[model samples]
Target: MHASAHVDTFARDHLPPPGQWPGLHFDLPELRYPARLNAAAELLGGGVPERPVFRTPAGPPWTYGELRARVDRLAHVLTGELGVVPGNRVLLRGPTTPWLAACWLAVLKAGAIAVTVLAQQRPRELRTMCAIARVGHALCDVRSVGDLAGAGIPGLRIAVYGGDAPDDLLNRRADAGPFPAVDTAADDVALIAFTSGTTGRPKGCLHFHQDVLAIADTFSRHVLAPRADDVFAGSPPLGFTFGLGGLLVFPMRAGASALLLEQAGPRQLLAAIAAHRVSVLFNAPTAYRAMLGGLDGHDVSSLRRCVSAGENLPEATWRAWHERTGLRLINGIGATELLHVFLSAADERIRPGTTGVPVPGWRARVQDGNGDPVPDGRPGLLAVRGPVGCRYLADPRQREYVRDGWNVTGDTYVRETDGYFRYVARADDMIVSAGYNIAGPEVEDALLRHPDVVEAAVVGRPDEARGRVVVAFAVLRPGARPDAEALRAFLTAELAPYKCPREILFLDALPRTATGKLQRFLLRARGDTGVDTDGDQQ
Candidate 1:
């Protein structure tokens, strides 16, 4: 089936070669969508009109009807006023705000592909995305407009929001009638989400219009089982896929409201949950761990469902949270290439250490280097195929990701006899020391069990005797100081001798990306500087 021709074929033309794409499966009846569909219409156009759609601490609540009107008006401004045409890539850079959410919906409503970037990104990163996507138009937060301007993309048109600006999106005429959503094909590229690029240059993950709703219908509908009355809250920036699904798509799909906080730390998130009566929480394990320290002061009884992704959730963290709140952390493993969670379990089905079975409408397996299924309980590459899969825009690495009709995520895992998948490490993260293969996350998980350790990241350093030696960077809990020898001894009780860290370096905090994922590559860069003999210093 040929996709409906887009006005600007830049994105379609640059998609990975047809044969390199994973075999997308939508066999489930609910997964089947019409050939001509607009995700913006499906996600935001049909909801409880009088029900609140978004609420912030200081801003007035926006009902579904109000958000729809704002989106329609913005669509008119983009098409009628700014002359945006179908297939045009519009860059969106901003914090998590109602305006930013409306702008994203408006871009899709206007038949343009949305290219979102974190507001915290520097000029260099912005330039890279702009050049790669060939962006000609942008909607930026007022505070980030200067950085967007510094990107120096030729012929770029930008409109700022959230502050006084001559060309602010909020200032656009709202008197116009509702602008009709564009009739985009189901397979038409709707978003170009760039990867976090911790190891290398960020690659654009092109998602189709149908891919947007697939995540909500499959994961949110089946795994999360959200209700229309649930109020969602989270810390991930909207630019990230995890955040997009958590804060917007999932809630909107369930006809629920989302609490959009511009800036959310552990403290602020806890306060919002109590103040707004938020019931559904989504954040990384690090944020959850941080919140554990302050849980005594807040009434988080309002939160019924807590979702953790973006990084592996250690069993220690999961057990601690469950023990305290009587709510099991719903751990999921997803990637930008696949849109959202594909492996997860909710409620009673959740197993503390394993990242649940394949989500409904998806299939997963562990495969060896030759693309054959590995034996159960043996570690190998994780491969998945489902309603949503990878399609990198013009990246040569596309060939490496999709093999034998499966999206070979760079993660290593072991599938148990009962079909539960346990994460071992990233394919590139396994450390080989003296003929022993060790997963860095396993060691980090062990260190986190220590009472004084708040956060831990482990990497391998080159050694003269052994090929590599495990090293760890730890963040101590407030007012708790533990020496390196004590941490090592603590690890000795929990981990095998070969799996323990050779040295532990204390830092104020572990380096992480905007989305709270630890940057092990950065730690590896510092690992070769020689192990610090003295412990409690940054």
Candidate 2:
């Protein structure tokens, strides 16, 4: 690797062994980046200085020149007054807004590794992520600093933004001149994205400067092609790579603008599409399904492209939206490890029930348990190889995710003869509810903390409105009665609201195998209903 600009070298030292990495391919011409590159510099430099690049509902649009100046001043503050150096992990906590986006860019510009987390995360979740990433400095929005403060990370320096406090980030004194971009190596780590802890412990996925740009060149440039005049908006939080790519990176790479919304429900998205003339949209199937029934009087004629992910898009949902709007939904599947979508279909190439072929710089296939290639029509593991792949920070699970030069995503799929991939189901026990990946064991652990709870198990049950809802079965102590709301309230204080169980059922005892192992499969089969240990309905 080229000489890195990072002085601390913590992120580089924690990366998985070189031999454990998946095969990387820079096949496309645009995928090849220079040895010395800064992703923030690359993204911000592409836009025309006079054109608007970011917009909020109540605030005026910020053009490229204005945004650049803000980033430069923030970068100066980060390095000059805050005593930040290259390779420092700076945590960004806030809602999705222009200031949050600017803070992310400024961290990259100052040669620091960004650790962005969701605003809805509780103190427990925040503490775990910050511990894993070894975060020292934090820049949080004034409204969202309460949780981060509650996290109680020792020796963490906190700075508030978007507030009138004396020590606010915008109030810091710094030079207004342009700050030279850090001469970071293309392979140097730029950010560490933590998974939702699908396995009960969040793993940080380290992405390099070039990897950040590669996702844009492959997916945004090849599949969901955007025009400079387009306005992008999405529902996913910027903490999720889905939102990071669709709402910010992809649009900025194409010299387009984006409208950032703090609360983007179906109704809000529809209103924004009409109010801002949004052209390109990114959301999950659940939102699209909800919007189908309320399209009357909403002027969505400006929307030309819609991208859906985070959950499987049903044929029924796709057909209803297409029929209502005369626009085909681009269904794709992506993982946090891979950074962005590698398989997608757009425009005339879309098939209603299948994910399209691999993007221009990616290759994908189905493989069996032993890592052997499966037949075209057989269901197996989805294995993909691309320029951007997984690199876990000090996590031993790297062995399970990458095998034989391919990243084996824990999703079962079948590749057809025509090269289209069909989604089957998740191969693991992780529950995906309402486009959010919620770990059953994590919720179970939270439930077990209650004094009345003896044993607990969580599963995902299909729901018409949310695609799936978290259903939990608990075996309470003998005198305790079943009160779902009480247990839900107990969980809300510890975990994110989305991770709380939507429905709780009482069971005499949790089912187990002969060796005393949890039989989650049995619970999944008996979802939404409680059954006694004797296999009889309660």
State each model's CA lDDT, in order: 0.90, 0.88
Model 2 ranges off by over 4 Å: 197-199, 429-538
Estimate, for each residue in 297-360, the C-alpha lDDT of model 1 and write its tens digit: 7999899999999999999999889888888999999999999999999978898899999999
What lDDT score goes with residue 474 in model 1? 90
- Residue 355 miss distance in model 2 (angstroms): 1.2
Q: What TM-score does structure 2 among the candidates reach?
A: 0.83
- Please name the candidate that would achieve the greatest TM-score relative to the true structure: 1
Mark the 10 consecutive residues where model 1 has the least summed lDDT.
Answer: 529-538
